[model samples]
Target: MNPPTSTWWTWLAVAALGTFHGINPAMGWLFAVALGLYRHSRRVVLLSLIPIALGHALAAGSMLIAGLSLGLVIDHSWLNRICGTLLLSWAAWHALRGHRMRPRVGMQTGFVGLAIWSFAMAASHGAGLMLIPALMPICSALPGAGGAAGAAGPTALIAAIALCVHSAAMLLTTGVISLAVFDRFGVSGLRTKWLNFDLLWTGTLAACGLVQLAL
Candidate 1:
């Protein structure tokens, strides 16, 4: 059977958000480009994405799992409000003190360090929190979603698939941008041609909160 319309939209929203995340330099592509330049190896840039993606999946997956658990006890409407409030608060915090939360990593950092940096960056940015709104309908659609005896297994499987889909989109976007910048533009141009997405990021976060509340 064809999936429901809401399911399609939820998947699309997850992917669209992933693409946005990949576009944001603070997400990891810029760091990947820098690392590639530092090591003077395109291969290094490609390899770095693995850890970055892994760290992001872990960070976002943690939130998904938490939300799934909470969905069992909390009403869907209340959950939405909770996530919306949190998203708004997070946006405000990001606007006010996000810079202080960004983890500093040197070019000489190893794979593990890069993963840790990505995790810290994603967590601070509330990347996973952004997924909750999309995740709600997904989990809610499953059989016995609210504390059902047999629902946990399918819910987890579906959540894993959703996370993979989102992460894949993010990885692909990040790889494209990273390679393009490293191959054609080089990082030097950033000094003169950087597009600051901080405001856009803040705005998007607020928008996501609004969406959650509206839903």
Candidate 2:
């Protein structure tokens, strides 16, 4: 079934956010290219996409689950306040101390390790919380959308759709960017430019936090 016309923008926004996230090097492509370069193979870089996508999906999915749960227990105003508080707090932590809580993978990282790292990075950055406002409406539209006890059907469905759309967009971008970087400028180029990305990530995280508060 087609989603409501009004909600079309929301889904588009979801996809857009996915694309936006993918563009950020911290999300996956940068690391994947580095790994490939370390091993001297393009195939490894391509293989890296699977775990990257999986970890990102899990991280984003957790937030949707949280949103669904929050709807059942609290009113929207409270939810807004909580989300805002959390986002701002995370931003503050990152600003003052940096992501010390971020997971560290060994030089010889496995798929599971990479996935864990991705989840930690995504969660600490409040990637999922950024989508909460966009999801809350659809999650709360139907009767018991929060599912008094079980997962609300509509909430689950929409969250799944959002996750899929976001993941696909992210994966596509990550693959393309990874390939381009590996083929053209080379992995060293990614390392040279990474410092700038660090600054951008911090600013973006803080900006998103402020946006959550505004919402």
lDDT of each residue in 77-124, candidate 1, tens digit only: 898999999999999999999977778899999999999999888888
Candidate 1 global lDDT: 0.86
Q: In model 1, which residue pairs have backbone atoms overlapping below 3 Å?
A: none
**Candidate 2 lDDT (Cα, 0 to 1):** 0.76
- lDDT of the candidates, in the order given: 0.86, 0.76
Model 2 C-alpha lDDT per residue in residues 8-110, reported as the tens digit of each score: 7778778877887888888888889889888888999999989988898899889867866777767766777777777677667777666466566765898
**What TM-score quantifies how close candidate 2 is to the native fold?**
0.86
Best by TM-score: 1
Q: Choose the strongest candidate by lDDT.
A: 1
